[model samples]
Target: MSQAADLPAEAPSARVLVDFDRVDLAYDDTGGNAIEDVSLTIREGEFVAVVGPSGCGKSTFMKLVSGLRPPSEGTVIVDGREVSGPIKIVGMAFQAPTLLPWRTAMDNLMLPLEIVEPYRSNLKQNRAEYEARARGLLKTVGLEGNEDKFPWQLSGGMQQRASICRALIHEPKLLLLDEPFGALDAFTREELWCVLRDLWMEKRFTVILVTHDLREATFLADTVYVMSRRPGRILVRKSIELPRPRDLEITYEERFTDIVLELREHIGRIRKA
Candidate 1:
């Protein structure tokens, strides 16, 4: 059967890049589902954030999207195809920078090209081109002067920034961020949020960010989905209607706070349930 046959006819005809239809995941042969009845769709170039209480499967959701784990039931589709296993179309960044401490920032960014195909095979031949590309990405993320520095030489924010550059170096169609800035100081954390916002605005890659921070979700996502407690399900899908080119100043405004509060209420209700 065709993909269209999998859904109701009344559904909008917009292009959907990621679709999870009543998905579920189990860790063992007879274990209970980690997440159940999961269904959501994300379109190309859409910036989406997933927020939830602790142990609510927010990270599990990211894993499902990236094909890091197969669903015990239901379909996991992306870029118009079902995800059976890990695919090259995804770029992932976790809470820790996870950069190779021995390598320079520029070298770290180029790491993906060494592991991925086509680029990996041609890395030697395209040395200059790839180096330039790495340099360009470094510059884009404000890492120009520190490209030669090792991971430890960079601050937490800078290392995370480098991690993002590394993830994007392959130019994957989808970017998965799992609390990439959660470990940073408050000032640094917020600073990286704007950095991320600017990067998303410029690159337009599809993003599925799993974060605990409500304000971060409100500021960065075009649409934020709130998940319930374990066996997680989307409880709310709130669209961030704030205009683009957003700045830190916008976060203090009543409108932004209202949305954050609204999401918080939903979480509180989920917890209470």
Candidate 2:
């Protein structure tokens, strides 16, 4: 794996934004935990990826971080506060675009502002300003001309782009992505990876991406964490020391391949356990 010394010397010192302290989650009284003994800290503006075999509670980690599910044991802290319910500082994009068919791409992007606080209250009063921001986000993700198009009118890649824009339109401090590119073809998925990479480079938002693709995790995250099966626990925390502003070409490099294979070995062991 690449070493931290490879990172730029000018990297900013970041405060811890999300902390899971010996967290465990049990969905039912059966007493079987979905995730157990998970402890990690994600610094503000850090991009972290969680990967494991199917049913390893990767998505459960996202739920805990976003406050959708409270842990049965331990605590989850976000932005200096313990998370008790759905948090306001997080934005999420999932495998499915989940865009409303009736709404144009621009309207879909504006949904967060229409529902989330502060913006929701002032939406009518500042509709023009909000729309301009939405348009800019769409343009940033290569959806400039497609803003007027409905979800059905856009291609799969385009719709995913719109989904990401919607997640960012409100500019949440933490962004959660759950296999956001899993549904796309290989080429399209790689393309969206670059789109997401550029967006993260520009905004530097804290991101927790739950993915099964080791290569995807290696390419996008500052750190990649591997989890155990069932009662998921952090097995490894691999810091990616590849210098920043990385392009897709770096994915083919020897170090990148080594990192991916190392993550793969962890997953293989967990699956065979």
Candidate 3:
């Protein structure tokens, strides 16, 4: 199988933001590894994607970065610090959106500010300021007028946009998206690709997205890491050399199709293995 390590130094020489050194994870003491020999570097402000088939430990990789699970072997470090527990500097959005049904879009975005701290501790004292930030974020994601609407009131696309806003409200250095667009319809999902692309262009926060969609990975990530089937590890790290800010139009180009096909070929091998 192809390997990312064989590729040129795709990551920048600036201070490494995330460093995984031959990492491995196992849930049960006697069970096999979920992921093994996974070492990679994610630089500051880079957008990276991790892709693999179902049950291939892609989600487990996210948990390891978030400090939700400890690696059974090797080091998992972020921003120069080994992730020992839940790191406050990381923000996450998932496939479900998981917005509180009772809250409005604006409230949902501000939820992070109320939960993650110094903002959390001072939320009450700075409610107006936080509300303004939420409103601005909503506007940025094209949910300006929908701020007062409940999650049920928004379409799948809008809700996902709000979820991303919530993740960014805390201004976390790293944003972890675990299949954030997986549940949307194809059209809506593509629309969100633009939404996310715009947001990332504006914010430039480091991102590590976990998804099964090769198209999504190619369009969004600066570097795409394909994982092997369980006992997963980084199989390929294809740097997306596409120019940005990339638009939906770029997706139709021959170059785009070639990259997707190349990645699909790798996945085909992983599945067969």
Q: Per-residue alpha-carbon lDDT of model 3 for 1-273, expressed as tens digits? A: 344452323335466789999999987975999999999988888889999889999999999999999899999999889999998898999999899998888888887787788998999999998888888889988897898999999988898999999999989999999999999999999988888888888888899999999999999988899999988988888888888778888889999989999999999988887
lDDT of 2 by residue, 1-273 (tens): 323342322236468889999999998976799999988888888888999998989998999999999899999999999999999998999999999999999899999998899999999999999899988888888888887899999999999999999999899999999999999999999999999998988988888999989999999998888999988888988888778788899999999998888888888888888
Candidate 3 regions exceeding 4 Å error are 1-13
- Candidates 2 and 3, the one with greater lDDT: 2
lDDT scores of the candidates, listed in order: 0.87, 0.89, 0.88
> Backbone clashes per model, in order?
0, 0, 0
**1 or 3, which is superior by lDDT?**
3
Ranking by lDDT: 2, 3, 1
Clashing pairs in 1: none
Order of models, best TM-score first: 2, 3, 1
User: Which 10 consecutive positions of candidate 2 have the poorest summed lDDT?
Assistant: 1-10
Q: How accurate is candidate 1 locally (lDDT)?
A: 0.87
Model 1 clash tally, residue pairs: 0
